[model samples]
Target: MATFLRENASELGVRYVIWQGRIWSRGAGDQGGWGRPYDGGGVYDPSDATGGHYDHVHVSVRR
Candidate 1:
């Protein structure tokens, strides 16, 4: 992913690229330490405390 981002950085106007994993268990909430959400969706809310319901890698590219 890094290679691809770097190769196309000029045309893509990429500024930041984030590669992360998703949650495998529903009981898993945002670990907070790794900047990964337990739900594998959006920003996690600590107040929910319900944990996440999905799992997958999160790839974000910022221009």
Candidate 2:
């Protein structure tokens, strides 16, 4: 989960983390929280859970 990755990002070599349409880089302090509209305020639709990644999460690692 986001909390775990954020706590161990440095040690785990995490480069980025994405969940619910919001992104968090290793050092980017929560990115000011998720669910902010983008691209004409339609990038994320709260009711549909379609634009945002409400179902799954994505993680990236450093090589």
Candidate 3:
């Protein structure tokens, strides 16, 4: 799913995506896509199953 979104990001207006503790942003470009890891911080509880987004994918779209 991440690969598909990254492939068509321009057409889909995808700003970024968070999944499996990693993040990919259009602004960062392909070379850095998903290279950055996302720590839950205060938003997601690391102790929880879905806190690190291990069970799901979070897609952020541009308006």
Candidate 4:
């Protein structure tokens, strides 16, 4: 689901996306497409299964 939007962000007017806690913006750098490692502010963690897109996905679209 997230991959679809990311691959087609321009055509879909996607401004931002927050899923599983990680965030992605239109102009943001690659940076692994996830949050920082130390802050615990991101959604993905190898040791933690509860972090990443397991529950839901949040998307911000442009008007």
The best candidate by TM-score is 3
**Which runs of model 3 end up more than 4 angstroms from their true locations?**
29-33
Model 1 pairs in collision? 22-56
Q: Order the candidates by lDDT, highest first — what do you get?
A: 3, 4, 2, 1
* lDDT of residue 55 for candidate 4: 65
Tens digit of lDDT per residue, candidate 3, span 1-63?
Answer: 977887798999998877777778876744454637677767897446698777887888989
Estimate TM-scores for all models. 0.28, 0.61, 0.76, 0.62
Per-residue lDDT of model 1, residues 1-63, tens digit only = 544654575566655333343222222333564334344245764234332322323234454
lDDT on C-alpha atoms for all candidate structures: 0.40, 0.61, 0.76, 0.63
Per-model tally of clashing residue pairs = 1, 0, 0, 1
lDDT of 2: 0.61
Evaluated against the true structure, the overall lDDT of model 1 is: 0.40
Rank the candidate models, highest TM-score first: 3, 4, 2, 1
Error of 3 at 49 (Å): 3.1
Error of 2 at 7 (Å): 1.3
In angstroms, the error of model 4 at 23 is 0.2
**Which candidate would rank higher by TM-score, 1 or 3?**
3
For residue 31, model 3's alpha carbon misses the true position, in angstroms, by 8.5
Task: Kindly give the stretch of ten consecutive residues in candidate 2 with the minimal lDDT sum.
Answer: 34-43
Q: Write the residue-wise lDDT of candidate 2 on 1-63 in tens digits.
A: 866876688999988766666766754554356423222135556344544555666567888
